[model samples]
Target: MTATSISPKSSPDRLSLSELEAYIRTIDTSEYTKTRNYIGGSTQLSEYISRGMISLPRIRELVLEKNSFSASFKFLNELAWREYWQLTWTAIGDDIFDYIRPIKDTVRPAMPEAVINAHTGIVALDAGIRQLQTTGFIDNHMRMWLAGLVCQVAKCDWKVGAAWMHSYLIDGDYASNHLSWQWVAGSYTGKPYLPQQDNINTYTESLQKDTYLDQGYGEIASMEIPEILLETVDVLPAHEATLPEDTVTLDGLNELKNADTILLYSPWTLDPLWRKQDKAIRVLLIDPDVFSNGRFSQQVIDSIVWFAGQVADLKIICEPVKNLEVLTAAIIRKSYPGITTWPGIVDEPEMLFPEVPVAFYPSFSSYWKQIKKYSMTDQQSLF
Candidate 1:
């Protein structure tokens, strides 16, 4: 995909905190159905972050409105998931990827037709998938619904569904998408939550009543919509890569004016237009699908072709799973001599930190605050 044509200005409108609050204010207070649907179901704030209009702190504040104990916890928990992925990367270094592959292999030997065609016969899930495909937002409840289908019904791996969902959703976070799918698949911390047909029917009216008539759902009758439980844990900041010993200084970049370097990205944060600043290089190495490419390779192919011109050096690096070594191997095989993957701080600087599971980290918030503070000043390092 050529970076020249994919202008951020041309993309869809992203919802802001004020807009979200205003939207909430307009809803009928007595209509609990719409309240749950709109507040719990919405994913538009992620779209704002994807569009670069809001910061993560802003997102955290807007989402963590403690209207009740549960609402506050759930909103913050989602943000913690994002933090956890970053922390996991820092703690395990490249080994985080090992945790990802087996899960992928177990669930997805082949991409399932029921998922691809939206024919799981579960209407809420089908509508969720269709909505995700079309509008790029699915309710929190529907995410579980669709993910459950991918695991239990479609018999596809959670990674496959997670990968595809990451590509399509504007605000898809690596930790939440992958881990939540695992949670549904009975691989994450808790028991596998397979929503029964009656539970689906109660929350969603779009499904045909007789579709799951024979499928057993006795436990689903007692099932409740799950919410997040929050806890505080220490965390390293996201994208905390090490500054290379021989890294070019700001003065050095201005002085050289002649280094012929190709741009490569170690994607930490999700940005739609990641390769725009590299006026010097025609070739860019990136995960064409933005998150990972297990499920929708064709869409990523089209997106890459649409944004980056012809792909010269294709390297596959799915975080918490694939590493720079694997990606470097691919780049070398492609004969792209100068292409390099961005090394994480865990690999480069060599620090010891906690192996804490996902949690809200208010205590360690200021410790690594300056990591990306100099991003604008040191923009030339990656390219």
Candidate 2:
């Protein structure tokens, strides 16, 4: 789910808390339970939530201020699914990138050339690929269809397609993106997700029929990879996206001698309002290790820069974790995916439900059952 095109109520390139706040006030989540499965039916908040622009807690605080808990239950559950992946990542670091809880018939798959070229015989899938490449977004259902086409049909390792998709996503979070691919491939959830052509047409409103996917569940489940999808090309993750040294505008970073405190930001933790009142050196620190198994698109990096600009005097530091240096002055960062162990005060990421699973659970249904117990109350939303 390291995720849009609804763009909410403002420009996707630039958004503020005030703008997002206004958007949730009027958003109708009551219909989300029924429509979110459609290509354009989602509320379009994944990009915002993944990048720390907004959080589950903040969303609940805002949405509940206007809408009832029942009205937003389905919406909240969707958000919980995102959190579930993240929590799983926290429990088992880096391992989420691999195929786990396997079903059967997994292979070391590569990117199908037809998929990369957006020439897949499936009209909806081809368009989804183009949209993902061009705009850095595709609906979750579209994403599922694409994942199924690649993993189940092509029978490649889920990591290959997962890494490819993460590299281009504006909201790519490794935990969500990789684990989700495994879910579709049946390695994570123990059941392959084979979305038939009829399902795709119904959700995306595309009418083309007689494609390879145009078959019943039983027939499609047993079908082999179509000839069109047999040709594949290995996709290496773009070497950790970086801004050129000449383009790096920040200076005086190698030595932070005079700095009292450094408030850090990462690709995963770009909360503009975090520590806003504190008089500290705001830093958007790019630690390469933060990109687990895959990297963010350049557009995503640009979004990071834009959000940093919102914070007063925030500077950029592009260094791998191993080569990083922050001597003398104290440093602090939000406890994010990769920057968790950095030598400084690291704050735990804010959570909607602070009650995390004591033991790892392979499925969301299991994880949610444990978390559902620690609700604000049974009658209230556990957001």
Task: Please tell me which predicted candidate would have the highest TM-score against the true structure.
Answer: 2
Each candidate: RMSD: 13.7, 4.8
User: lDDT by residue for model 2 over 1-383, one digit each (tens)?
Assistant: 00010122335555677887898887778877789989889877887887788777888788778778888888888878887888888888877877677566857557888888899889888889888888788888888888888888777777889878877887777888888898899888788898789999999888989988999988878888789978888765353555523242233643344678878677667787788788876666666455433456666665565655555566666557544463566778887664556667888877877776545688888887777676655757466
- Clashing residue pairs, backbone N/CA/C < 3 A, model 2: 2-171, 109-156, 109-157
Quote the lDDT for 325 in model 2: 61
Give the runs in model 2 whose Cα sits over 4 Å from its true position.
1-13, 237-251, 288-296
TM values, all candidates: 0.52, 0.90
The TM-score between candidate 2 and the true structure equals 0.90
lDDT of 2: 0.74
lDDT agreement of model 1 with the native: 0.42
lDDT (Cα atoms) of all candidates against the true structure: 0.42, 0.74
